[model samples]
Target: MTLTLHLDAAGWREHLQSVRNDVPGLVPVAKGNGYGFGLARLAAETSALGVDTLAVGTSLEVDQVRAGGWDGDIVVLTPWSRHDPVATALLGDPQVITTVSRVDDLTTILELNPQARLLAELLTSMKRHGLGRADLPALRSLAPVARFEGWTIHLPMRSPDPLAEARELATAAQAAVEAPVWLSHLPLDDYATLRSELNVEARLRMGTALWLGAPKTRRTTARVLDLHPVRRGERVGYWQRRASRDGWVVVVSGGTANGVALSAPTSAASLKQRAVALATGALDASGHALSPYTIAGRKRSFVEPPHMQSSLVFLPGAAGVAIGDEVPVELRLTTATVDQVVDE
Candidate 1:
């Protein structure tokens, strides 16, 4: 079965504009499989949209925008390191911008190549990596070798009030050198609120909110492949989905290949607090369909466990639905890989 992802470009552009209204400056984040858009296409789109800048996950991503002839500034979000020769080269050129996370890393960058435009990464609670508030002055002290492009702060995801944390970080950013620019990965609502409160101009680094902002922006669909009626107590699939009652075993064309079964726990508490994990110590790579899909514009449920290449849906009364029928997978397409992009 072919995986199909549909994008309503007009819808997305409008969403981007709505998000832009919250923050005066926008830095669209085009990284990590390009949020399933592919980096180059996103770069082109963001460039055309007149964003202040575009941030990528790595130095390698710089080639993506440059190859497309995008003349806008490309910011590398990964923490600075000396080993990143290509990144260093791109920074040496004025075409790229970087985030300085550590005093030593920033020093190495300055020593390796002077005249690098840089944004001082103010450490946040996420604790992934960044220069702590205490270290900011020392790094900023190295003004002889580097020019402070702006200030940056990364907000934690799923926080109750990302705006509050952003405000706190914005307070710390005031200590940084001139030209403060904020980059937030938090929820758009939070970023928008804190952005308005910030004393300095803000650039919200948006990924999911821009590409997968809402269901209205995109749709994913998979076709039904096969179907069979099974009697009670009949076995089906590796899980031996025994029929609790008379129903048809419907085979759908979607599986691990489509990232159907691939999902990490929602949070630590969701996994740790539960006693019986969903598939812990399971006999095979099998599980119920986690992704919701619509059939005939009606919601459908997973009949049994999903197979390796396909999934079996328990279609009790929907036997009237047949093969070649198009079903929309109710999934966040940004998190799912798009096998094909069908417009309209």
Candidate 2:
């Protein structure tokens, strides 16, 4: 038994079609654990959607998508460099496109593969990577040898009115390099609005909102492998913390290695959201953390921190569960690794 992500295949297919139909020039982003469905699975789904281009996080993932039989163009979102020589060599493939954030990187890419398809990333408010608006003019020189596919921008969620900011960035990007702009974090309405507002074509590079768009169609769960009755003050789990009351200690099939007890930095901006985040942090520090796994439709407390491949959950005696039973788990798909993915 293991932590598994079960997908409602029929409903998921419908959602995929609905998204494809809604968003035009959609570049399905299948990157970073493939949004918990794995890269190969997303690649196959992209092919099924008749998409011409798929965006992956790193150059190394290009081959994985190709291996999935997606002959379409694969765009690597991360910038290329000498660090990954093998991936750099893979840039030579006509079907692969690399994102060039710096002028120097553009030079390196050209030197490595003169025919490399390139997407010039514009440095937005994110400030993570990308060339500045002023630097875009310099990229015009490489438009000849290196195939200038388009410009890419990553807008931060905290940006005030993302649509307005996106329009401004799109306008600036066009002045430097007049090409289609590949962007992320735009709602369907905003995407359409931006397209109408600007003369350039816009391609939405989406991951979470695409594959995991409809939460109802995706079900993640961990199987209950073993159970042990425990009394108050009885120690359990790796830390051997004493249970507060009489209950059963559950050995579930997911743990830290599977993304349990792991947390990514929150992007919460509102007052209530920030309050919740702070409270969650406090709860986590107390050694009485809330688990993703739920029993009797109520989230249970973890006996202690998750182990490498398993977690110890404390279920109340009243909420009974047998071995080999499955419990619902709400997890961040981006950070999770499911032992099995049942598509049915």
**Highest TM-score: which candidate?**
2
Q: What lDDT would candidate 2 get against the real structure?
A: 0.86
Whole-model Cα lDDT of every candidate shown, in order: 0.72, 0.86
Candidate 1 regions with alpha-carbon error over 4 angstroms: 67-69, 83-85, 160-164, 185-200, 238-241, 268-291, 296-309
lDDT of 1 by residue, 233-263 (tens): 8887675767767877777777766667566
Each candidate's TM vs. the true structure? 0.83, 0.95
Model 2 segments beyond 4 Å from truth?
A: none
Residues 36-136 of candidate 2 have per-residue lDDT tens digits of: 99889999999999989999988778878878778898888888777888668877788888888889888887887788888888788878988887786
Model 2 backbone overlap count: 0
Model 1 lDDT, full chain set: 0.72
- Give all candidate RMSDs, comma-separated: 3.9, 1.7
Which residue pairs does candidate 1 place in steric collision?
Answer: 303-313, 303-314
